[model samples]
Target: MDANGGIEIERKFDVDELAVLPPLIDLPGVQAIAEPVVHDLEAVYFDTNDLVLSAARITLRRRTGGDDAGWHLKLPQNAGRRREIHAPLGRDRQGEADAVPESLAQLVRVYVRAAPLVPVARLTTIRVVHALIGAGGETLAVLCDDRVQAERLVHEPASAAWREWEFELVDAPEDLLDAGQAVLAVAGILVSGHASKLARALGDRLTAESPRNRQRPTPTGPAGNVLLASLGEQIGVIRAQDPRIRQHTLGSVHAMRVALRRLRSVLATYRSLVDPTVVQHLRTELGWLAAVLGGSRDEEVLQRRLAGLLDREDPAVLLGSIRDRLTTRSAADAATARHTLVVALDSHRYFRLLDALDALAASPPFTATAGQDARVVVPALVTKEWKKLRRAVRRATGTVPGPERDLALHEVRKRAKRLRYAAETAHPLNPKRAARVSGFAQKLQTILGDQHDSVIARERLLRRGGVDAYLRGENTFSYGRLHALEQQKAADAEALFWKAWSHRP
Candidate 1:
């Protein structure tokens, strides 16, 4: 099962008091409809006093009397789609019901922070479910008719009742939905205006302080506009990855790290357009966040590379317990890294950083040069980064292939990354030229990145000291061989970097 949750593709419709569902078996791609199954479900929803989760279009509830009864969290994905995560309902201190699972609660920490969560609504639903089957007997979709009664539990209790129909896709194509909609329209049914039952139950209480309503206006002038746009784009990335990182989704940490780097690069590259002191402070915080995330990212990369190398080697040459050792180390590192990340997320500093980012987006402190044309200002910034890369590369190639030269090349790699980010920022103005520069910088970055990986691998191998091999009754010859090979690969990467630089644009 996906830790982040499963994607749900479904649509809802409001029905009149006497309305009935149209024949779904005859819909396109649906061969038959199974007998209806009735379920009586009661759910209690939890949220902050201010309805933070509802405003974000998220819902968390504990449901009883269902086939998959447990805790369910639904997060909005796109129009008519949601990602649903589930957890078991274990016992609490009184042996009644447990509080929210730590795993699930952590995912929402970005929204609730230190706020207390309480029961906001309770709902009882009587649902009739019919499965739409294809010719091959595969379940393609499900049609549900629901009668719902909801009671607001907090801040002046109230009760309401309603009926609705929901058509949800299983493995069927989208055309089936169009057919279903056509049939429903003929029966005088229309899509529901509210996003969910919870939304309708809350009514006007679910204030309009949504992120969409809080978006900043477009800044004027070329420089300010470009800088603001890039900052806003990266800020969105950071926010989107927060829950994914909490869920421990694959590659989420690396993606969040890259977004932080891009945001920091924009601050540095367009410093003249914003307040210098504020940009410096933000850059420092971004650097700290990136370093925290990099811990696990580096371990993940090394484990993959070493495992791949071991897999391709001859069985006779393969040393004892190499794979097991790598696995143990990787697991330990990942646990520690994730703990560090969770601690940071739960801190006041992280919340303040998020607030600072929002403020920067909404009302940036623009300098005198912010009103200039981007075509004129952006090119100069790109040129400056390119020059920095050239100087670093020259210094790297000037030294012999050793630790000094390796360090120099690492500096070159950092410069290349900055230049690539700058070129990407300039893409909106001159796409063709920016593409050339970005492509060239990426090639350099890739070569040096491999070189750095080899360095890290060799250091790890040396630290191992053949303890696992000795315990497994094998010699340490393979470890020495691997180290020698990595050293040679690092040298080859350095050579490749110079060769690629000769054709730099």
Candidate 2:
């Protein structure tokens, strides 16, 4: 079935049994309220027994008895908004209760991994919906009064009941929501502290304080603390980008790729603070992921650069079908690369990799050095990477401009990236110094990145047989001119890098 998805922006307020809703029509920008429509919504929320999805504030449910009933996955977004993805409810080949629908399950795979999903809570809500309309008869927002009866289905069956009001924006300004809140305050309805219905339904199981919450303060002397925190941050990024990557959102693939790179860099840079065997294994797996994501990222970068360059070219020198050819090639390549990414994401190896990451975060293999002060150990690591970058830059600039120089510069770029990541991990402890180092490293990385792009673009242009200009009886001279221009740009970047290196702190 074709999927439907959108961002759901709404606010929920707890209402006492005796409270009455204030006039929504009088709210700013609301001219009228439509007749209330009632919906009896029966939803069974699914999650792993451990409630991983719920902890992350994601909800997946198969609902019936509503106008828009199906399997819905709600991913938490910023500021009381959710990105909801919906799939039509249907039985699997074996005729089960939709079997979580592959479309929705894949989105949460990063959280649940190989764990089995089961019904965690069953909720029956009687909803009275009012449409607040604008003067132009457009729906400004929706007001839903929900009477909820929730039963926890896992571990032990228990039940609870509540009434809440949801004010959801449709085509209204945010100020309208603020106005509605102010009006509701007069009637004593206040925003609920609970994040979601599932959180309220599961009660203490979902909200209970873990032992980690009660642990003593973080050790100030532990390099392991800094390294683990850095690893955790990247893991969070990887998980956050997983759903977006599955949806093929622009820049999601690159974000996930960068997260993997940073994770690998931290593991390598802090190998002395962790078990070598485990770190090596993680590094290998991360390399695999990076390689899988690189194809699409490279193509995406090349397509953007070529398009921008073509846009700036004079019409007189523009050749036949060049834009069309590039577009077609880029689209085809992207489609294939995206397919590869999806397959990788669905593979058993990928699932195991996620499990490994969770395991690492929960219990890292810290060595004796891990207990040392980050202030002492981290700067040494950053300095080591900086030295590596300096050597690579020196070798690259001393060489004549050619394929050899390009290769050397590429190495410099890689070292600069590692140095930047190391500096980032150290930034939490010493912000000013780390910021300066990171800034310098970023400048060098950008310059070398451009040179690398030019190298790749020239190779790609050559592979395309000079842009097919002969088809329109036009000379391919423009292609040669573009190639030479890219070369000059690379040379210019190299010279700039040398100048910057002379004054390097």
Give each model's whole-structure lDDT: 0.83, 0.84
User: Model 1: per-residue lDDT, tens digit, 227-272?
Assistant: 8778878877787788899878898899999999999987998898
- lDDT by residue (tens digit), candidate 2, 53-164: 8888899999998678898899888887899889998999998984899878888998888898899999999999999999999999999999999999987889999999
Q: How many residue pairs clash in each candidate at the backbone level?
A: 0, 0
**Ten-residue segment with the worst summed lDDT in candidate 2?**
208-217
Cα-based TM-score, every candidate:
0.87, 0.88
| Prediction 1 TM-score vs. true | 0.87
lDDT of 1 at 29: 79
lDDT of 1 at 316: 89
